[model samples]
Structures are given as C-alpha cells and as structure tokens.
Target: MTPFTSRIYLLRHGEIVEQDVLAGGTDLLLSDVGFSQLSQACKYLTDVELVQSSTLKRCSEFATQFSHNHQIPLLLTDDIREFNFGDWDGRKYDELWELTHSPSIGDFWQSPWLVTPPCGENMADFYQRVFLWWQRLLMNIVNNHTHKQLVITHAGVIKQLLGIICELPKESNQQNMFAVGYGKFVCVEIYIDNMGKAWPKIVF
Candidate 1:
C-alpha cells in the first residue's frame, strides 16, 4: 500500500511598521516592504490546496489575498496566534531589554518555559495550547486527505510547532537554529504509513 503524504507550509507573516517591537496584540498591518516580502515568499506556492492563517491582521490580510488569488480555501483561526506578551505587547524590544524587571526579555528568551512575562500568558500554557491545536490540525489534514496546506502564522507559533515535530527540549531556544525571518516559510512534510502511524520531518 502506498503511504499517504502531506506537505504543510508554515509561513511567518512579513515585517510590521514597528519592526523592533513586540506588537503581537497590537494587530499592526504589514508595511509595503513586508507585503512585498510576503508575496515574493509565496510566489512559488501554486501547489497549496488550502490556506490557514492567524486571525491577526498581519497574517490574515495576506492569507486572504493569497487565498483569493490562488483560488484556495482560506481559514482564519486564533489558536495559532503569537504568544501573548501582555505588558510587552506593543513595546519595543530594546525598551523591554532595558527594564528593571526580574524576568526581562532576554531572560524569557533564555528560558521561555520557565519565565512568564509581566502579566503575560504563561509559557507552559501557551505551549500546551499550540500543541493541542497542532494535534487537531494534523488529524484534520489526514482525515480530509489534504495533499498540501499553507498556514500563515507568527514566528513563535512556527518555532513551537517545529520543536514539537523535532521533539526538541523547550529550552532549545529554536530561534538560533530556525532563524525564521519575516515572510519566511518553514516547509514540513508528513508521512503516514498504512499502519496508521504518522511521521513528520522539517524539509527545510
């Protein structure tokens, strides 16, 4: 029996106006350069059969346009939005780094699972939410027999999903290895055997 194959493109949205800020909750739209980046990154995405996106404007705007242009079905969801930064939601990174807080931005990056930002979503809870969302997503994909799907989301979400697929430690600090720049897409290929088991690999 032939194994079933699925390809999912985890695309990070393009740059925003305040490129240096943690504006996940601010919902800032992408800049012109950012739109260009997103478009160019998706130039070769003709094979995608479906498109999913974070409800945030930065990702959804482009996802809508891509879906319309490519004639693919589009879905907007909140489960895959960026990690809530709370008080740091709309602040610049440099500003946050200069804070006198105990667990500063640097501290969080070094040990995200252990450090919860000021009034922000707990890293553990965030991880669990994304993980659950991912599980449901894969099941849906397999059940629907989808060949290819595109997901437009944030850097943190993509990194978390990648870590899940690789079974990496939460302290792995995937930013160093992934370095998913704005408008970049991490290609993942999933293989399901006839025995009803699934294996996922990061193709890029």
Candidate 2:
C-alpha cells in the first residue's frame, strides 16, 4: 500500500549541572557545555516546522530557544520525558552502585525484564509508554497537512525509539548499541501506509 511520509528529529538533552549521575527524571538544568552542544544542533536544524520537548528543563530550555528563534510552534509534554529512575534518580553511577548493591546494575542491563531497580521504573512500563506515544504521534500526523517536527527528549527515549524502529530485541543493550551523545539528533523518516501501519527509518 502507498504511504505518506514525513521526518521527525529526535534529540537527546545535553550535559546537565550534575555530571556523572543517572539523571533520569532528575529535572536538572543544562550545563554550559550542554547548552553549547544544543546551539550547534540548532545551526544544523532546518525546515523543521514544529518543535516538541520533554517537560524537563534540559530539553524544554533549548526547545524554547529554538521555537522562539525560528518562530515555530512548540509543545511540551511529559509523555516523552526520560524514564523515571525512582530512588536511583540523579545519583552517580559508581556511588549508587556501591551504595545499593542489591540489584546489580550489570544484571539489570543484561536482563531488565527480571532485575527491577529499587523502586525504579521497570523496563516493561517504560517500553509501553514510549511506544504508545509513538502510535499517538503517527495517528496525529497521518491525516494532517504536511509539517516537519522535532522532538527534544532524553537518551533513554531516543534509544527506545531506535530499538522500535530497528526491530531490535528488548534484551539487547540499546544504550551501547545506539550510543546517542548529548545534543545529537536522529532524523527518523516516518511513513504511514494506507493501512495505517507506521514505518520508520533513521536518516542520521
């Protein structure tokens, strides 16, 4: 079946005030270095008619600048915010690991479905919310007049979306596989076929 296609830029937030932390749902603002990285991304962005960002400051701060500068529309939503790390949120990796040795970080990554973080978000729930948001995105854009969109979110969100687009297994380590750096953007070309199935491809 024939399909209509559009592009969406998925961007990860830049460096934050608290460095070397888990940083999920921490609500930390961008560091100087982080803001610079986003400035570079801004120069690269073109033909983007709309901007959407996580409610978190690191993402919303830059998105606000981009939208205002380019006079494009902007939407802030919690659906695309980083997965909440719960008790481990905003803690240093080494410190948190040493502090709470019950659930090994290594084990969690290897088998997230089995090893749940201490009061942290389980992998399954994170996956559900992200994919559901994606479905809604496709539904919203499928029938509307053409508009290019940009999404500013966290590393986890970007990685999950990549896994979905590439059809990768849930057991794989998306963090290492995708390895999206701060301020980098992945251009995903999305097509909704006549049957309303969505197909996505990363355009780098």
Candidate 3:
C-alpha cells in the first residue's frame, strides 16, 4: 500500500443532565446545556470535510445539525455507539452503590477489561468493533485522500480509538486510559510510512 496522511478530529458528545445515571445505549436527546457546550466546541473546529457519528440520538442529533449547516458529508452508524451497559442502562449511580454495597461499578470503570455490566458488551469485543471500524475509516481516508475528518462519538469509543492508534496492549486499563470531557475534541495526525505502517500523533 502507498503511504498517506490523514487527520482525524475525535469529539465526545456534550454534557447530559442525567450525569449520575448510566445512560449507555439509551436514546436520550441533548440537553440545553449540552447544546451550549456543542456551540462552544464549534468555535474550535476547522476544515472538517467529512463527519461521522454514532447513530444514537444524542450524537446523531448534533451531527445532523452540524453537517447540514457546514455542508459536510455525514455518516452515521452504530459502529461507534457507547459501550452497552445492558441491564445497567438508565440506572442511577447512588442506587446501584447502595444495592451492591460496594463500588464494583467504579472498579469496572477502573478496569473495564476485567469487569463488565451484566449482559453488556465486554471490553474485548468492544475494542475489536471500534478497531475494526477505525481500520475501515483509515482505508477510506488513505484511498480517498480525505483530510480533516470529524468523528462525534461516545467517550468510551473515543478512548478505545486512541488505544488502538497507540497500539496499547490488551491488559491495559481502558477506564484509566484516555478521557475527553463533554463536547471537547482531540486532533490526531495519522501517517503511513514507507513500509505501509500507520503512525499516529496527537496534534493539539
């Protein structure tokens, strides 16, 4: 394969009012504060030719609005949805703590690969899914010579994407890994070397 360069802007969704609840996989809309957060984030974006987002309502809503206003191509898919909390979806943090009588969920947050919500997608599988989609996106960027692509996704997906690009090992703790605050964005530059190996660098 020929060498190529691609720049990706990874963005996390804005703040949600129900911060104390585990809303993964839930189809909640963005709150007014969240919209304000997104508005502030828009000031920092530049040269975004294409945008992709998780089809979940919170992400897709903003993505739709942005693409329409900026005249950028948009792609929404489930490939980047937040980690599935399954039965834990929509549950409150304090209530779960009282019921479990321990901070097992917090432990899961620290080392997701070792603990999973009941009936939820395990970290390993989630990693594979996100990595696979990333590979596809890389191919598209290299083939089409696309520059400045934006991805609006959940924090978990963003972290895993960074882990894959950084080539982190399986045992690495994802919860303690990369974190992006609400409505914030991180930029990375990916370059394919002479040997067709991909290298990534954080670019502000």
TM-score of each: 0.93, 0.90, 0.89
Kindly list the per-residue Cα lDDT of model 2 for residues 9-99, writing each as its tens digit: 8989888999889998889999999999998887867888778899999999999988999999999999899988777888899887686
Candidate 1 ranges with C-alpha deviation above 4 Å: 171-176
- Over 91-129, each residue of candidate 1 has an lDDT whose tens digit, in order, gives 988888899868788888788778888889988887888
Error of 1 at 9 (Å): 0.7
Candidate 3 clash pair list:
none
Give the higher-lDDT candidate: 2 or 3.
2
What value does the lDDT take at residue 127 in candidate 3?
82
- What would the TM-score be for candidate 3 when compared with the true structure? 0.89
lDDT of 3 by residue, 1-204 (tens): 677777888888898767788888988888889878887887768788899999998889989999999899999999999989877788898876655623367667777788877777888888888989988987777667787888999888888777776777756764345779889988889997766566788887
Name the 10 consecutive residues with the lowest summed lDDT in model 3.
Answer: 95-104
- Candidate 3 residue 71 Cα shift, in angstroms, is 1.2
Per-model C-alpha lDDT, please?
0.87, 0.85, 0.82
Between 1 and 3, whose TM-score is larger? 1
lDDT of 1: 0.87
